[model samples]
Target: MSEFVSQLSDSLYAVFQSETFVLLNTVDQESGGPTSSAISWVYAVDHSTLRLALDHRSRLVDNIKANPRVTVTVFGQDTIYAINGSATVTQDPLAEVPFKMCCFDVHIDAVRNALFYGAQLVAAPEYAKIYDKRAADKLDSQVFAAMKKA
Candidate 1:
C-alpha cells in the first residue's frame, strides 16, 4: 500500500502554485455518489492549504456547501496524487474579476499517491482554452491574482 502524507510536499506545492490540470471531486447531495469536475484555477496557499476559484453559478458551490469534504487529484512530479481536504466558500463574488467568481479555501487532510505500482507517467496533462485568447488570458490573470493573495 502507498503511504498517505498529511500535506502537499514541496514539489507538489510548487506545481500547484501555477494553474494546472486537476480534478475536483465532491459528493453528490442527491444520490450520495462521487462527482468530479475538471478545474484549473487552483493555487497552493501553503503546504497544507489551497485556494480555488470557480463561477459563482457552478454546481460545485452547492456540492461543497452540502459536503465540505473534497478531493483534488493532480498529476505532477511523475505521479498522481489525491489531495483530500475540506472546503468552504471564502468569497461569493470575487471583486477583481469582471465576472462573478466564487472562491473556496481547502484545508488539506491527507495526500495519497493514486498511481498504480510499476506505472510511470510519461508526461503531465496539458489543456488549451478554446475561447478568445485575449479574453481568456485576462480572466486567468485576474483570477490567479485574486487566488494568490492572503
Candidate 2:
C-alpha cells in the first residue's frame, strides 16, 4: 500500500471506538458520477472489518448490491483520506456496528496524526482543533461498550 493508504488505515483504527460520522459517496448508475443524495452516514470499523447499516430502500445500499466497486473518502481535521476498494452489502448483523465504529475511530486517528504531520498544510489550525473537540462530544460510549460485548 502507498503511504496514503497506510496512514488512512492506521487513522481508521484509532477512532473506531468513537462516534464520528462518515460521508459515503456512491457512483450513480446512470450518470457514472458521485451523487449527493443521502450521501452522509455513520459507520463503524474494527481492524480490517467494516460495517454499514441503512434502511432496505436506501439508494446507496442498492448501488452496492449492483456494483461492489466503491470509493470511500474520509475527512479529518487537517487531512483527508480517499480509499478505493470493493464492498459487498452483507446481511451479517455481527459485523455491522463494529465496522461503523471503526470508520469513526479511524477518522479521529487521522485527524490527530494530521496535527503533527500536516498542521501547516491546513487552511486553519483552529478549524482542525474545533473538529477534534467535537469528536468527543458525539461519542456514544454505551453503544460502543455494548457492541464490543456482543
Candidate 3:
C-alpha cells in the first residue's frame, strides 16, 4: 500500500478531534476547477467516512453531486492534515436543524501531512501559528466531542 493509504487508518481523524472546521475543496462543474470553502459542520461518521454538512443553496452541494471526489484539509496550530475522499450527498441530516441541508458522506481514500515533512518527520509549528487565532463560530463543542466517540 502507499504511504497516504497507510496514514488513513492511523492518524487521519485523530488530529481532527479538536478541529472545529476545515477547508473543503469542490470541483466546479462547468470549469472543472477547484473551489475552496470553509465548512462549519463536519464530523466523522466512522473511521473511513466523514459527514459534511452543506447548505441547501451551496455550490459545493451541487458540485459534489456532479463529482463525488473531493478533499478536506485541516490546518491547526501545529499540524496540517488533508484527506482525499469521495463524497455522497445525504439529505436532511438533522431533522431539528432548520432549512434544507445536504450532508455528504466522504469516504477517505488518502491522507497527507501537508506541513509536516522534514528529516525527522515532524510538524512545522511556524506554519500552524499563522492560523492560530481563527476559529469556526458555528462549531458545536459538544458535537465535535460526540463524533470522536462515535
Candidate 4:
C-alpha cells in the first residue's frame, strides 16, 4: 500500500504546469456511479490546490456541480499520483478565452503514489490533438495563460 500526503510534491506541481495526461473521477449525482474523464488542461495553482479548464457544456461540469468530491489521477514523473480533492466551479466562460469554458478549483485532500510496488514507469503518456493544430494551439495558449493569471 502507498502512503497519502496532504499536498502535491514539487515534481507533480511542475508536471501539471504544462499539458499532462490525467484522469478525473467524479460521482454521478443521479446514479451514484463513478464517472471518469481524460483531461489535459490541468494546472497546479499551488501544492494544495489545482485548477482545471473544460468545456462549459461538458458533463464533467454537471457532475462536479452535483458532487464536489473528485479524484485526479496524474501520470508523470515516472509514477502515478492519485490526488483526491473537493472541487468548486470558480469560473464559467472563463475570461480571455474565445470559447465557452469552465474553470474548476480543486482543494486537495490527499495525494497517493499509486505506482505498483517495486516497479517504475518507463515513460509517461502522450497524446496528439485530433483537431486543427493551429486552432488547438491557440486555444491552449489562451486557456493556460488565463489559468496562470491572478
- State each model's C-alpha RMSD to the native: 1.2, 8.0, 5.4, 1.3
TM-score between model 2 and native: 0.52
Badly placed stretches (over 4 Å) of model 2 are 1-3, 6-8, 36-44, 92-150
The per-residue C-alpha lDDT of model 1 at residue 90 equals 80
Q: What TM-score would candidate 4 get against the native?
A: 0.93
Runs with alpha carbons beyond 4 Å of true place in candidate 3: 6-14, 92-94, 119-150
lDDT of each: 0.88, 0.46, 0.66, 0.88
Q: List the residue pairs that clash in candidate 1.
A: none
- Candidate 3 per-residue lDDT, tens place, 92-141, comes to 44343445666667888887666645524344332232343434322344
TM-score attained by model 3: 0.69
Candidate 4, 29-144: lDDT as tens digits: 77889999999889999999999988877888888999999999988677888999999978876889988888999999999988989888888878899999999999889999
TM-score (all chains, Cα) for each model: 0.95, 0.52, 0.69, 0.93
Clash statistics: count for each candidate: 0, 14, 0, 0
| TM-score winner between candidates 2 and 3 | 3
Q: Any idea what lDDT model 2 has? A: 0.46
Off by over 4 Å in 1: none
Compared with the true structure, what per-residue lDDT tens digits does model 2 show for residues 1-81? 324333335556564445455556567766677754322334455554444444444566656656656555555545655
* Better-scoring candidate (lDDT), 2 or 3: 3
Model number with the top TM-score? 1
